[model samples]
Target: MLLATLAGCSLWNSGSSKPLPADLGANVAVLGVRQAWTARIGNVGTLPLDVHVAGNVVTLASADGVVAAVDARTGGDLWRATLAEPLSAGVGSDGKSAAVVLRSNALVLLESGKERWRQPLAAQVFTPPLVAGGRVFVLSADRSVAAYDGATGRKLWNQQRPGEALVLRQAGVLLAVGDTLVVGFSGRMVGLNPDNGSVRWEAPLGSSRGTNDVERLVELVGRTSRVADSICARAFQAAVGCVNVARGSTTWTQPASGAEGVHGDGDAIFGSESNGAVVAWRRSDGSRLWTTDRLKHRKLTAPLLLGRSVVVGDDTGLVHLLSRADGSPLNRVTTDGSGIAAAPVVAADTLVVVTRNGGIYGFRPD
Candidate 1:
């Protein structure tokens, strides 16, 4: 039985007052960027919404279950669909079929903006479904993994792991590396055979150390950085590690106190610390290469490596682009002023960011 739910597990620590966010005194335009196009959806508020990008098409959903596929190049809607209920998790698509979990624990699949089928789930899901190979995979809060036929809503298989006394209410890892379905169970990154629910390999990144249930929570978060066969992920506020999927072995693990995910190029991995400091680590050995406290106490989302810049959104709706090599500020952009709701993503050379008030703005090099 699940004993407790830890919401926004990475954002808070007890008994300590947060420092004021660093003052962003003036706008310095070093790198030129212009808002290319803008779109709107329902207020996302604090949802764990992942913006799914397949080529130039970007699929995303609102808290009220309004899913839309926007052309990343032109900011035009390819299609839009609305479900009757609010969404718990969603907008996973393969450019063909999209899957989202309703608040009622129903997995609803859509094709070309039309509802294909809906199936009920036994547990709550916060991670966006992984839709690949004509299958929809969901990782629920109860530590269960299930797959369904993408076309017919028929249950393909279900695998349940022993539940922890406490679990996070935020999104956890659920991604695909080649033919294997990789998921996070507690602090271990487990690889499973996608065809049938079978364990391929399990690599531990963090372990329960503290006495209390809250302190022992070490589940992996989403938005992991993958470079070829090597995938790197953050184990909550415990550690950052990379696993060689091909060999089913751990590459490296370094202590990381971050609540968000990580992103990187092949050489270095970048993440934002819980205190809002940005850090860069060597991908090969997990060595700390650089750290920037420019955004401290700002409440940052996960980092996104785009070209020569590490893009990160803050709680005030400002997206900062820093030099990937040395963590220097390159440029900063603004959004709806309601704060950024999700991490910034790139599609067709346009940087797309969603605001808490449901503003989707696309930016391009000016």
Candidate 2:
């Protein structure tokens, strides 16, 4: 299976010998960021766990099926739950309810840190379940989407598309734009009617090209940047583009070799290339604004636009803060030395990052 092959290969490294991580020069502390509080969860290992932020709460899960909601402002535990089976994907929440997928292909729903109900799925899920508008949406590896009542476990609807020969084992795009449920199917950004799981519109961001399935893979990744009606996402290692969800048309697409997703503000979109170069592009025309290779060879997560800085975490347990205007270093912070497990998220004025060793650190401006 493609999943097994992907699991063993490094998306960023193609050669036999891995390159050394870039050297980080002396810390020139420009931005004033301080660790506010630290908490612990079960080790995340390699699971594609997403840190979900809603209001002041940060919802996350560990590979061992331990899910918890923490107050980003105070680092206080709001609620925590442990599922019977280890999780394959998770930490999706709507503040009131949470959902996750077990390794056994079961969808579990929780409310107030208690399991509400469970439903069985036909395929493996890597993307976190999306909980929105009293419904929980699950996107599986088999190119299928299913919806269920958030309050109950009753299945509402299921929509299956033609399965591709291979699909990425990481998180793919699935979000809500106004009243439509926007999802990623291969290289396309599709808008679906949330009420009935029907297709509303489709916009292609990447297309198959190479001879083999692996080279032709262009699944859209998550951690997308959404500014009002404009949603920008990365199509695996193929390209980055933005779509007008309201008009159901693609605005622009620029070829970019990146395996991770992207994040941006109103004027610019930022992404980390597979080579670890940080790039900023004009959101309107997809033109290059600036590129920095100082952090090249360091595996980076999808960037987060925080205030005047772009925040990115690397495999060395370092969170880098760079200038939004020029991609220059502004500040850097250290975690538990186990590397960041997911992209950084902001909540209640606190910047939260999770480590692979299960350390959750909350930072605030000093």
Candidate 3:
């Protein structure tokens, strides 16, 4: 899953700080990693982009308006298409269909290299659109959630809500989990019916803690992960916590300063803080397990728990591998010089990462 804005100290800055130079941790090698292959998709422009993974197909869209699907293992293109306008959001697809939002607020859908349908939006879209159950869902910047008929590009229903005075340029995501459509708004998560825009349940993950609006921002981490009965989410300068998706109640809440959100294994939840500390906590009790600030202030992407290893990307184009048990750096690898902007994605045992400049790499640890 890709996230919009990790958010800076404030919403307007958009975490645009210069990433500190790469620091290769201690020289001991604990894991053997091999680069499987590399490919050039296209430049992703200045915005944070995401690569969509469905089954074994990895789909990508570029700021240059090019979209392609490649074999996740071979790094070979299966199909490719180009748009006349640059894309504003990452590519979203469920294998059978692909969708992208153009800079012009037009949501374009494609299938088998041919244009399927295009729907215009009233506001710009920053997050990856959601495609499920033959319906396309989008959360626009204007704080409106709408569903569109996937087959005919017809507008189904739209739910409008008031948003904050200022929101992050890096948008949040739209998730479809089972029968419920999960959406992260300014400070809460809402579960809505995928068929209609009706709200099924709403849960507050975090609340405004600051005295003023800017400082009071409590936005959902947006990039949420599910582990068994738990639906875990994090919020900026708010809390990292989970709720029982079935009951729509809070499971646990821990004060946190991370904006990128949390990832969970069966027993533990992992996150990379805004300050660059990779921390872990027990899944059941929300107890702090361990934390390592070795990569502090590096502008890290969210952490990916790969078995016993924790994988995270930095703004310096370096991927860091750390011990899941104690948060120790085990190994690191360098990619295209443009640095990594999106989280490293995994399909099976292979890890794929995209560079800001357009290089994609597949890595396997043995």
Candidate 4:
């Protein structure tokens, strides 16, 4: 399906008989946008490299294996590092430390522009390395989860599960909630002890219904953003549900058809559907509030809550702003022709986004 291809494998180049749709031009404008600065990371081809914001620094990585940290306010380069091999997934960080998964199935940890340690991984990683609790957690393409010592890069514990042959290549999320590390893997949300990788609780968020393997594949989409007391997540065409972080019980379940995942703004849950539709639901009861089809057929990234609007990028380097209250189109903007591949990050007063063509842009909404 189209959702499977949105997992960063260039849906535009898919061998399918259907052709990709073109992005719509700027139409309605309500909110004003002021671009602060634009920077280049590297050429965007296939590998997953994202922009991560921690405190005042935004870290970015490129396919050619160049990593840099830029000042969120002025887009000034704070530090830069180059890897020997191409990067697969994006970068992850705890503000103080950062991690990246290499094309050689290796994990590299960086801090203060220096390589702290490097460790070989058994399987190829499609998800970003998570740094938390003095450990680095990684979810590999083989459906394996491993934790390593943050300083020494020593393998501490690992867990593996059966994976489908054709799995979604999009990066799933690893969240740290209290003492447990919540991991989104193959249609399931798992809570594991950060110290030992033991399963404390698990919730089935997706089900296999397709006769073919690709249709049957169910994986988490974007990073799990916290909404009130619950943690909400979306599965690739499987389901989107929220669970209490403390009890690990489902709060609600809805059919998930998005490749880019979901976002929440304290009051409402927003998601970009596979059909290019944007929908908002009540965070309290998962009640549908509004849906907009203006961006239909456009490959949209995950929704980003900015001010009172929901911002999302499309396949043609277009950024859309929708009302968080009713999902109405408020404004739209275009990037440097390279479509945005990663979710927009909020850093203080500006919004940051990265395009597949290696363009990073900062916009200040006015």
TM per candidate comes to 0.97, 0.97, 0.93, 0.93
Candidate 2 — which residues are off by over 4 angstroms?
1-5, 8-11
State each model's CA lDDT, in order. Answer: 0.90, 0.90, 0.79, 0.80
- Superior by lDDT: candidate 1 or candidate 2: 2
Task: In model 1, state the lDDT of residue 159.
Answer: 87
Extract clashing residue pairs from model 2.
none
Q: Relative to the unseen true structure, what is the C-alpha lDDT of residue 99 in candidate 1, on a scale of 0 to 100?
A: 92
Note the clash tally of each candidate.
0, 0, 1, 0
Q: Ten residues in a row with the worst lDDT in model 4?
A: 1-10
Candidate 2, poorest ten consecutive residues by summed lDDT: 1-10
Clashes of 4: 0
Compose the digit string of candidate 3's lDDT tens values, residues 11-93.
43356575563465456668989899898878875554666788888888778788888888888888989886888887778
Cα lDDT of model 1 by residue, 1-366, tens digit: 444767774437454675789887777777888999999978898778999999999999999989999999999999999886899897789989999999998999999999999999998888999999999999988899999998788999998998577887778999988889999999999999998989999999888888877887889998899999889999988899999999888999999898899999899999999988999999999999999998988889998999889999988899999989898888898898898988889999999999989999999999
Off by over 4 Å in 3: 1-23
- Across 190-298, the per-residue lDDT of candidate 4 in tens digits comes to 8888888888888777877779876677788676669655888898776778878788777887885777678886678888887788988877778888988878778
